[model samples]
Target: MNKPTSIRMCAASLLAGLSLLLSGCFITPGKFTSELVLSQDESFTFTYEGEIFFLGLSSLAQMGAANEEFTPQECYDEDTFEDRECTEEEIAEQRAAWDAGAETRAAEAKKKAEEMSVMMGGIDPSDPEASEELRRILLRHHGWDRVEDKGNGVFDVSYSISGKLTHDFMFPVIEDVPMTNPFVQMIIRDDKVVRINAPGFSAQEGDNPMGGMAGLAGLAALGEGASGGNGADEMPDLPKIEGTFSIVTQGSMKIRANNTDEGPNPTPTGEILTWDISPRTQNAPTALIAFGQ
Candidate 1:
């Protein structure tokens, strides 16, 4: 007779199996705030700060392995294939096995966390002096930017980008490339911002890499005739995006109109515009900044 495992253990194992299939395409939800400061001479400066949160299976695996309170039991007898009672000794033995596996699971979890951290955070959360690979990518696409140390888990970035580039066709293409994965883009025409696109994250389309395990686990449970399985319409509660965007023009320039889809607030300072945004899908704009001529 096959050995019985805890429902949680089976769920974790099922997730592990699914993790392999859904590795690359996962959505992460997060928040951001950005400001575009434009000079009268057409020089442009943009600033951004934000945070993202996600759940990875490695975290789940670590939790499962570390938890020893839960016990596994065989519901049927091996001889007559009838119902049976699980003994205290059997539960203790199974708990011991899980305990032995905890160390290995912890190590694996650490490695996976590191990988995901780099992919999402773009830098080590603990080390600020580490390589600026993500920053370099931003420079290549946006402009040569400066990073300011905010001293307490905060970063303030300023970029002096080419104003001429905004009006060019290549701006959106360059921004959307896989390497940068920038959340915001601007398109200018006739020395004015004709359109701005903030295309949000990949998480909106059900590509969340972290939630893939739950999806697979649910399927496995349903296949096994588990009565408590969630319905197909139900989805994991994942993070969504909320943020603010602003633009201000210096000197004689004026924002004749705010054509952005978000319909941000206009500052009393004149030529200053702001938008509070919540992104629901990739195709939907979180914030679009348009300056009227």
Candidate 2:
């Protein structure tokens, strides 16, 4: 169990375990429409209407820990790299090693779950009560106009807020929920430059940090013998990232840089930059704006 050996195994199995080990804390966007309006006087209004997913890393880890099943170690020819029958002594030795470490691994997994629960405000994604708890938490905030749990860790929410750009801002800032990668961010510099980015708004493969948890859940379902052609249906229903994001800027502000494909389109109010996001989107939306003529 301790020695590194290349054994023939399904790549899905590796991904299943890796997802549990590395999924960690993260929040990502789902279907939604978002907009930001920036004025010449450094005032702004931001609105987001759509799904917000919260993945509980501890619950994922606990699932992994509880579902771990041992597969017999395989022996292979060193030179040819071909599978061969393992010796009786070798098999016994591997079993002994696995048994020796089982207790330690369980203890470590338990400790990690406990620590993560604290970090995530004791909300367990696997718990039936988690959705209501999350709704209550978000409703206590100012911007959240509505919060409805759509199951499978997805929440349909409507958030609208306005303020002067006196400091940096980030969305989905829930109280007691430890900070993870944000859905959207605006960083204001002392030089009167503002950088806007929507990291979790795109379907780019690696852009969503919590993306792996979906696979983890699917694998867990499969491992539990979810069959009869309904395994896919039984898998957790994670929301997809499909939405639109736009930014409106006053004419007095200078647009230094932006990644919009068609450039800014003129509107009656000012210039608007938009992105139609989907699974095909390869990059997240971003832009830079500077104050003063």
Candidate 3:
């Protein structure tokens, strides 16, 4: 589906406007589900020492992992990479595991999102000194603009501001406070946003400077961890999150989708394509925390 040139050109201009669409909604059956469409396909990019991570809001990793064992290998073929129909036992077990995982992740994510929202509310993003200072430290030398918002849980954010970036060195003690995970970044287009960017974190082979000592050093560290050592503490854990969610079928509003094949029939259709982030989270535990090691 070829989008009009105007829609493509006006994408950036549309980001800030769609952030609040979720804030204002009505709950009417067959009318309003009171759900918000993620305005962006992904969330903000948090770069630490050149490693880019995504922010996730859904405890999808936990839930998916919890339900993974229940899925028969036949349900997930490696060759064609197709998912076959599941048996009753698989469905029941997977549902139970997923349900349990959802409760844990949702509770954690909701609490964090609310806390960040409150903190942001207290701070004046408009204050020149405050905003500029925050933009420098938080966004890392990036300028920012507060995009207007609708009542939904979404809001516009602009980091590409004009002019130089300068700020004071005064640091607040509260600034050191740890924030929750799954920070979402929305992408907008054509006065409407339909995607979200979730943040994540990962740990790879730690920096080993010594040539022959490199592999040996890494092995020793692994030994320490195996011997109940805190070797892994030097790096952060992988954060899990829902990549981006959308309503396949529009309820009350008009459905404007691109790349959708109005074909005759296919076995499976719904492909919740998740972004393959840099660091992959563990696939075992259905419930886990990334912070505090």
Give the best candidate by TM-score.
2
Which residue segments of model 3 deviate by more than 4 Å?
1-74, 77-83, 118-293
Task: List, residue by residue over 64-99, the lDDT tens digit for candidate 1.
Answer: 223344456565678988758768887788788888
Q: Kindly indicate the candidate among 1 and 3 with the higher TM-score.
A: 1
lDDT of 2 by residue, 1-293 (tens): 21223212332454455444344455767789999999877799999999887656223333443545665677888998876889999988988998898998889777765765665677765566767987998998999999998766678899999999888999878887776567789999878899999866665436443242344444544433423335444344556678899999986887788998999988876788999987566677899998655
* Candidates by TM-score, descending order: 2, 1, 3
Candidate topping lDDT: 2
TM-score, model 3 to reference: 0.21
lDDT value, candidate 1, whole model = 0.46
Query: Relative to the true structure, how large is the alpha-carbon lDDT of every model?
Result: 0.46, 0.71, 0.27
User: lDDT per residue, candidate 3, 251-270, as tens digits?
Assistant: 22223332212311111322
Screening candidate 2 with a backbone cut-off below 3 angstroms (N, C-alpha, C), the clashing residue pairs are none
Per-model TM values vs. the true structure: 0.42, 0.76, 0.21
What's the C-alpha lDDT at position 279 in model 2? 58
TM-score of 1: 0.42
